[model samples]
Target: MSVVSMLTPGISMNSFEATAHVVTQLEVQRVSYMLVGALSSNAYGIPRATKDADIVVSFDSIGVVEFAKSLGVGFKLDRQMRMETITNSIRNIITYTPTNFDIELFRLSQDEHHKERFQRRQRRWLEEIKREAWIPSAEDVVIQKLRWKRRKDLDDAENILAVRAKKLDWDYLNHWTMIHNTNDLLKQLRDECPNLDVLDEE
Candidate 1:
């Protein structure tokens, strides 16, 4: 199934509208990051809402310090600190404001698999006056949410599961989960949300 098959109408317009503006600005400014997390998934029609937009970029080239300083030029940053850069790593959330959306920017890590995912990511959607793209695919999005291990992240994942259930490429989802060592979490989710299995698989 295609990405568009997953989302129903009106489930995520507000968030996308807000995201489009920021991404447009970034592209215009020649910033080199791709949006990830919920917004990314939602763009691919996963149907989930996120409080803020999460982005991953080649911060090694740009450097987190320089990126932070650049962001300060037009944003009111909330918190800025370093965080792991990979699946099991931590990186800082350089959150900012005034775009009516929270922007969480992070540098890509040196992990080979993480780097591969970054390189293979699909463009979020066709051009919309904003040269925007989302990093993690649907399956990866599920895996990351599970890794977070937060109640809210879990809930969000469940929502994605429900909405995208019909269109989910289970084989692909399983592949990424296993690669990321998140099979246990997928099992946990399957056990916790009994209805998940009943979802119409596209």
Candidate 2:
């Protein structure tokens, strides 16, 4: 797992502003997307220090290359589009490196149910001074994270489970886990962290 270091001292611009600029670009481009990952969760009042922004877009033909270029993201496209391509069905993850932060673009799976979940995303204006836009709902975050099924993502889910254990919708999580065939992972989580409550059964 890649353990990206946290921010250091004296960085002029905070990640929130940088992320907002990217969001503004996406908005200007009319891309149908929703913020996710650390930034989104943090924006939702989780308060995690995030160094990058992840925006999950529709898996259809969105012309993301043009969108990225329009934002002046300074990315070099591969002629074959191996690193970033349009033909692939799975969500494409493209990274944009600006000065202080790197933004990730996720082309979410083209599932109507999943897409609807994306539509259900709610933006919360977190903090008066920060004015950070984040998706505050825990159900959505946990659902998406479970779908991702990456090792780090699982760890993040566990951490979130640790924090929001008492409040999580265990029935929903369990149902989704069964649908996604990740009940083993839940079992593993429960095994490793016997004390940390996750599902409603606990």
Cα lDDT of candidate 1 equals: 0.58
Worst 10 residues of 2 by lDDT: 1-10
Model 1 per-residue lDDT tens digits across residues 83-102: 66345434455433433556
Question: Which clashing pairs does model 1 show?
Answer: 82-92, 83-90, 83-91, 83-92, 84-89, 84-90, 84-91, 166-202
Could you tell me the lDDT of residue 174 within candidate 2? 77
Clashes of each: 8, 2
lDDT at 38, model 1: 63
TM-scores for every predicted model:
0.64, 0.64
Residue-wise lDDT of candidate 2 within 1-202, one digit each (tens)?
1112132222334455545655655555556667777765553323556656666765344576666555443333332322223213334333433454556665655564366567677766545214434353566676666677777666666666666677777887777678767767766764665355433232
lDDT of each: 0.58, 0.55
Worst 10 residues of 1 by lDDT: 1-10
